[model samples]
Target: MELQQMRYVVAVAETSNFTRAAEQCQVVQSALSHQIARLERELGAKLFERTSRRVRLTSAGEAFLPAARQALDAAERARAEVAAAAGEIRGRLAIGAIPTVVAVDLPAELKQFHLRHREVRISLRSGGSEELIERVQQGTLDVAFLGLPLGVRPKGVHGRELARGDLVAIVAPGHPLADREHVDLHQLSDEPFVDFPPRTAARAQTDEAFAAAGARREVAFEVTTVDFMARLIRQGLGVGMLPAAFVPDVPDLPVLRLRDAPARMEHLIWSRFPPSPAAAAFLSGLGISAA
Candidate 1:
């Protein structure tokens, strides 16, 4: 019923433990529990199923969670708008990015944003481009950086292309093609490769390239991180393809230009709805007019 009660409910649902939720909310367990009970009574539904060991959300809680979060977000945005009108930014900025983001220097940008708006809180998260886009659409993230195969664009969100480039092959020092200045997909297809998980956008770029070339590549290692993929290549476990921007991360490995390569498009995305003041300021700092 009350905003404070909704906040307590959200914290409890997220932590799944009353005591931990109380600690997170900076209140005593008894007070937090009492407030939640009062809210449940007003709603005529039990929000949680508490046991001696674990606390689980009841069906009613599951149904109410999304709206509660949206309400809280709305309240926060209203306060932030008022502050912004007074020439101050005061709200949380939630940003999401793919792990291999190279289009912008995130750390430097965040530093500048913090210096400009000391009252704003910033949070960053890493995930797949598709996943990041979903989070932005759901209002969980105010903005996101994404990378996808060329010719593909993000849906259900406002986005713009930042950069696009071809991928290059990486090989170990003593490998057969290590000395080659350039190679085609067919030439690298026969070699064992290390790549991101199957069906991921990063992996799809390589997969689609090889398929178009009528070549088959055996994936010897399925890795989630660029560092691990580089390590596997350095050890001669397999060859890999990555955007040219990422080559500096594995400078020791030999990089070969792919004559027929998949191109990756990097983009900046945000919710179609108007962004929070913090998000708008961050975008303005980047010279992007926030929609």
Candidate 2:
């Protein structure tokens, strides 16, 4: 029933190893085990099934995990609120971003934010736009930089457009269409393409554009990172369509604007509920209106 016991249980469940969980909790393994055992006795149910090889959560533990997390989250939020009332900003801000969002200079912005609010902690995670948006809506992420297709908005979240640009085609110097200043979608329909996997914003935008143009492309390779895509293009594996900013600037690689391509939009997305003070300060620093 004690808060510390709840933390111990959650930690053990997350790590699935008593030794590692005790290490993370900064407690002796025996002490941590004793506290969890005491908690289990109080609850009249075992939380975890301990085996020599691995620790698995019991049904009771599985049922209690979400409530335990919520209790910890609420406690932290209360502490943050008290800190805010005292004119201090100190809390963890979990931010998510899509890979191509490098155009926004996030590291520099986060550095300035950190300098200004040294007590505040920032955690960044990278994922596809869909996954990032889901995390934000689920309250796991404070904010996310998402690459959204035009006119597509995630439900249960508020978004502010940060940047907008068109998707471009990138090719190696020796490629047949490398010299073209502008290429239409249909022109690359039959070309082998190195593309982002489905469910990513870039892939969705590319598919929509090609569908609109009545074109179908052959995807030879699927990659999640823009850097890998750039490498693939440089190796002449296949052509790629990505946000103009994501295409690397190489002497032999050429990026051409796609004719009639849909514009790619980057938005800072957050839950519709009020954000923590630290998250608000970050949004303010970035000149994004959290309202």
CA lDDT scores, all candidates in order: 0.92, 0.87
Which lDDT tens digits does candidate 2 get at residues 215-244? 888989999887888899899889887777
Q: With candidate 2 superimposed using the best TM-score fit, by how many Å does residue 57's alpha carbon deviate from the native?
A: 2.1
The number of the candidate with the highest TM-score is: 1
Clash pairs of candidate 1? none
Per-residue lDDT tens digits for candidate 1, residues 67-123, read: 999999999999999999999999999999887878998889999999999999999
Give each model's clash number.
0, 0
The numbered model that scores best in lDDT is 1
Q: After superposing candidate 2 on the true structure, give the runs of residues whose Cα lies further than 4 Å from its correct spot.
A: 248-252
- Predicted structure 2, TM vs. truth: 0.94
